[model samples]
Target: MESKRSKYILIGLSVFCILLIGITSFKDGFLNPLRSGVGYVLSPIQSGVNRVGTSLYNGISNYSTLRSAMAEKQALQERIDALVEENSRLQSEQFELQRLRELYDLDQDYMQYQKIGARVIAKDSGDWFQVFRINKGSADGVQVDANVMAGGGLVGIVTDVGAHYATVRSIIDDVSRVSGMAQQSGDTCIVSGDLTLFGEGRLRLSNIAENGDLKDGDRIVTSNISSKFLPGILIGYAADITTDQSRLTKSGYLIPAAQFDSLQEVLVITTLKEEEAPQESTENTEGAQTGA
Candidate 1:
């Protein structure tokens, strides 16, 4: 009896499930209301899941775009920095070239003398290049009293020399005196360096002959009688000329041709004026002996 009861229960369950399926298949079935209630319960959950997925995707996309933009900005900035550095280097080279060209032209202007280039290496404690040193020395044939020229005119003389260095005393030094002559009229005068007067960019002009015709704006050059300086090297121009109180000589100021404050490269004439004296003395001595 137990076995038969179990079989009947199984058959009844199968029939009930088939009847439920048939009832729910119709358009106007009794289960329609139930289906509507189940859909209403799940609709909000599905909509919420779709909205969350869209927000997560957008957040990831925006992060990627920001990173790309930042990388591009950094690259552009680096390029700009490199270009700026290159431009600065180019400008510095251009200025150096111009200075070299000026030096070359000055060399051509006084081509009669043999010259060697020397850069200013050190200087005394002052605003002016009253005394300075050069990189060249006796090893380079730089001797004492060698004339140094720069900036289109006479600069100074080499006073002391070393194996690899040399000291220069510029024309602006207080003890400096150069015998200069007017290029226009050949009138001679004495140019004395005075640091006090150089504050106004001038040197003292004295010992000018009363009858001399050297006037304002006359070009002053190294006189042929100058013992140290070579002849015809430009010193400066005359200015503010006046007669002395004694009425024996005229005195005034001279504007220097070479700038004293910013001496850089200079040309040292390797030929010394003293070198010519020995040969001249020998020639005179030989002539005297022949006459005897």
Candidate 2:
């Protein structure tokens, strides 16, 4: 009996809805109360659907705005990084220029000698001051036996040359030997590089005459008798002189004037020393002596 009653109520509601629509189409104001009641029943569902749509639209808009802002920030950060790198590069270039200028001034001071400038390209693979390569070589008129000098004094001599580079064996190398003299007392000595004396940055000066007044702080210069090096080039100062076991001659340490470890640029003298020629006897003199 309850089921039958529910079916009847549903059927009555359908009829009521159709009648309400017909009345509304006829423009009848008398059914306003019924329309008001039905509108009130549906209002809450419409409001809920509108709220959900607004919430979804707002979420999408916020996500788009955040993505755009992040992209802009990343682009700006990349640009800032590029600018910083460029600044560092420029600073390094400026420092290099200053160093080259100092080298140029040094070359100008030795204008009396025919000189060529070269940049240090490489250092010896094994030791610090054993050997180094210069950017200039045969193509730049650099040849074997060219004297190399640094800030303080004579550094070494060129031993090998290539098309674009030259190798110099510094005076500190074990293979190097130079004829040196005490500038003050004219004492002659042989300066040789020894591995044992490398820690003191000095070379062994031997063969000083026993009677020679060799003293500490005496300046040592390259002697004219040296075949490879030019005459009168400053080499170093004397230190720790003492008699050898044989007591036949004095020996000491020569502190090198040139700072081999800090060498960056150098000048290679191109002019060779003029050689003196032997005088020839006249043929008339020989004939006169024979006739006499």
Candidate 3:
């Protein structure tokens, strides 16, 4: 019975809605004022709802756009950082390659000498590499008095060695001295190091014969009679050559071929000066035997 009553109420409401629509269609209908009053009450409410919906839609769209822009910005920043790191790595590699090429050319310049490459591992106090240690030692055939070379010319001699490391005293050391000769004039001179004067990147050249032909810019090399240094190895260029006050000898400065301010890698010539003399003696003895 309750179901029947609800069915009847729904049918009656549907009929009433159709009749109300017909009545409202007539312009002179009795409900015209009532319809107008209802419209006036609900119009503002409907407009307000529509405005709120539009605002919500616009807000959602703007928020999505901002989020996308932020994501893109973050990605671009990461890309820029990666590119900067790559550029730095490439620059470091290029510099290392240039240094290696210089060492290779130096090796070719003294092709007659057998050498082992070694890296500088430590140093004494001061700005110059006046005294430093190398990674090679007696285990690698490095020995005391073995010549150490870098930067296109002679750098130092190995002074001490252990099983795994060796110490070098460069030509710029305070007590270092070399017997050098002018390559062009065949005149001998003394090349001495002074840590104080090497601040200007030059060594001392003195005791040259007064009548010697050595001049400014002449090439100087290790003399043949040098007890320790190998013969014909370039030391540096003569500069500021002047005659002594007594007219007995000439003294001047030498701009060293090697730069001692920074040392990273070097070549250790395993050949000892003492060993060379014995080889020459042996060759002489063989020649004498052949003549006999």
Candidate 4:
């Protein structure tokens, strides 16, 4: 039955084509209007299909361009971030180099003493360096009572020593008392720590002579009479010296030479105050035996 239906359809299409030919032959112009009518009806439909195809092609092209642009922008941003980080690292290293150079000069000034460099690993609570830990210890010739310094002058004394680390008690600590002598007139004074007023970065200077020639900005150095500190180490300048009401002694504030808050690296002088005395005694004993 399907084959018979197909055969009838084919015959019908053949007859319709013959009819069209015959009509066209009849007047030579009968088929012209029909052709024109078909063309007029299909023009808008053809245009619509072309427009749809063009829109699809343009959309795909624009999407690809947008993706490429976005990828390029992401790559550039990552490169910029990497460069910024590298620049920051370089700047930090430059600053550290400058500080180490300053410390090198300070070390040269004390050529008589054996020294080692140590980085500060920890600090005590507060704005001041009341106590801090360094990377060097007894194994590095850093014994308890060893003198520590940085920047321009004396910083602290080693209070504890371990195999690989040491602890320092800065002169700005509450329990610190550094005997200071005036570099100008040899007048002696005491530099006592008082954190109650440490916010000013000044320690209490006292025990000055009533007629002391100490004036404002007189350089104070560690006194020879100091029990623990080596003499001649610069402390800081005297400021605001005022005699007590009794007039027997005077007291004032002293700004420390070391920047206590931002201490990063320090130098430890291995010589101890008590060690010098014993060595001197041994020398004296040998000299006496030789004399005998």
Largest TM-score belongs to which candidate?
A: 4
Tens-digit per-residue lDDT, 74-112, candidate 1: 999999999999999999899778767878988999898
Single out the weakest 10-residue window by summed lDDT for candidate 2.
Answer: 283-292
Could you arrange the candidates by TM-score from highest to lowest?
4, 3, 1, 2
Off by over 4 Å in 1: 1-70, 277-292
lDDT, candidate 4, 120-224, per-residue tens: 998877776778899999889998878899989889888888999999988877777787899989998888776777788788898899998987799999887
The residue-level lDDT of candidate 3 at 202 comes to 94
Cα deviation at 222, candidate 4, in Å, is 0.8
The candidate, 1 or 2, that scores higher on lDDT is 1
Question: On residues 166-208, what C-alpha lDDT tens digit does candidate 3 reach at each position?
Answer: 9999888877878889998899998888899989889999889
The estimated TM-scores of all candidates read: 0.73, 0.63, 0.75, 0.80
What is the full ranking by lDDT, best candidate first? Answer: 3, 1, 4, 2
Model 4 regions more than 4 Å off: 1-51, 278-292
Quote the lDDT for 198 in model 1.
97
